[model samples]
Target: MDEWVERALARFPNVPALFGWLGLDRRGHWLIQGERISHARIVETIARNYGVDDHGRWFFQNGPQRGYIALEYTPLIASVQADDTLMAHTGRAIESVSALYLDEDSTAVLDTPDGAALVQGADLAWVLDRLRADDSDKEIDDQALSNALAVPSGTQTDLTLVVGNDRLPVYRCDRADIPATLGFVQAPEPRDGENSN
Candidate 1:
């Protein structure tokens, strides 16, 4: 087990941990001990307590057990900003959890649930700001935007294409959800003029 997973297990005993590519299961569910929990339930819980957006995506920290969960999303090429309220809410959630592992004294430090030093006086705002900036949206064409919008809805559509150095996929998923084991190959280009070429 990763040391972070161990630490998280020790600290948050009630919380179940799981790690896999593709964010939550495609069916949007999680299994804990022998019981099952829906991803919608988790999102509801987080939203009710921490104020995440209904349509927003979440990034669960990767480890043998769950580490810290970051509620954010990659921007679609069309939109250049994440919901600001969602970003703030995520920062607050991190702050609350970090407080559980950190101490009050300026110099005091504790091991984070993920085993990193939960140093006192760290600027969480700065971290949140950086994350928000990293998730800043971009401009994409109409087709790309349409493809991205279709993914979460479970529509089977061609949303990605490789052109030169660009590996463009229209979906906005948690980065961790991308499978490392999978490799993409370019499709053969169509020959001139003939529609069936």
Candidate 2:
């Protein structure tokens, strides 16, 4: 959080948190009232203040007020950089990927230090290029990928994602189970007895 935002929080601790007004799309674009936020400065500021509450709900600390963000999928959206490094939507560099998951739609989800992130559609090719066979140096072929996707959800695929010097196991996860598996809430609602607007 910025210094001024911290000060504001201390000064007004009772400000009610806002909801349904802010959202994060799968492509990493921030939206307000379902409209994209194009202002660079505002977008950057929101990203800087973004965080998660104890309840697993992600939000942006807007000075004294909290603006909860409705996630389209995972809290973070990761993209592969030109140097093959991973970067999150919040502009944080992904140091390493601890786990990899593939949903029924074949979208890739990466568990990193920052959080579980869904790979951007544009970077799917990059992820495919790094896929390797289970416990082997050989890469997975087209048939291998097809077979992996054919397995039932919640099953471990015989595939691994090679990122940097780390090799992470790949699991088949259903889209409905993503939030619980990743430990995040996609659409956060107000808790019992809490105020929301």
Candidate 3:
């Protein structure tokens, strides 16, 4: 949240919160009225102010008014920057790089920060770049990578991939338990038929 935006809330305390009008799509793009917001400045501004309420709803604080967002997937969306660094959409360093799972859309869901969030497909190479198995950190091979993706069914089994200086776990999450496993709401509906926008 921005400081100037906080002051605006105090100045005009009666502004109502908008519901289901704003949205954050899978690729970390902002959407308004079912269309992607084209202006970079406006999109960045809203992303900067994005936050979750007590009821587990994500919203953008537009000056004093709260514009609730309907999320197509998880709240956090990110990609690997040009420098090969993984970053969260909120512009934070994705820390602890714990676990990875492939979603139904074939997108990577990284378990870090707030619950699990989608990782851009192109950035996935970095996650797979240094992966190694067996008793040692041997250089990645074609067969090993293939075996990693096809883990035995009904198990927590996954391959250990090197992330930064640490070996992180990666696997394919079952489609049915995605929401339960990741601990995030895939689709959020407006509460109590409310529309503050």
Best model per lDDT: 2
lDDT of 1: 0.27
List, residue by residue over 7-72, the lDDT tens digit for candidate 1. Answer: 765776655432222222222233343244557755444333321112222323333233222211
Q: Give the alpha carbon lDDT tens digit for every residue of 30-92 in model 2.
A: 999999999999999998999999988999999999999999999999998999888999998
Question: Which sections of candidate 3 miss by over 4 Å?
Answer: 11-14, 104-106, 139-155, 191-197
- Tell me each candidate's RMSD, in Å, in order: 19.8, 1.1, 3.1
Better of 2 and 3 by TM-score: 2
| Predicted candidate 3 versus true structure: per-residue lDDT over 1-197, tens digit per residue | 88989999999987867766788887888889789997988977887898876666678899999887777777888788788777888787676667777544445677875656777767777666666665467666777666655664224434676777877676766655666676655545556755454
Q: Estimate each model's TM-score.
A: 0.19, 0.96, 0.79
Between candidates 1 and 2, name the one with more favorable lDDT.
Answer: 2
Order of quality (lDDT): 2, 3, 1
Model 3, poorest ten-residue lDDT window?
A: 149-158
- Residue 145 alpha-carbon offset, candidate 1, angstroms: 4.8
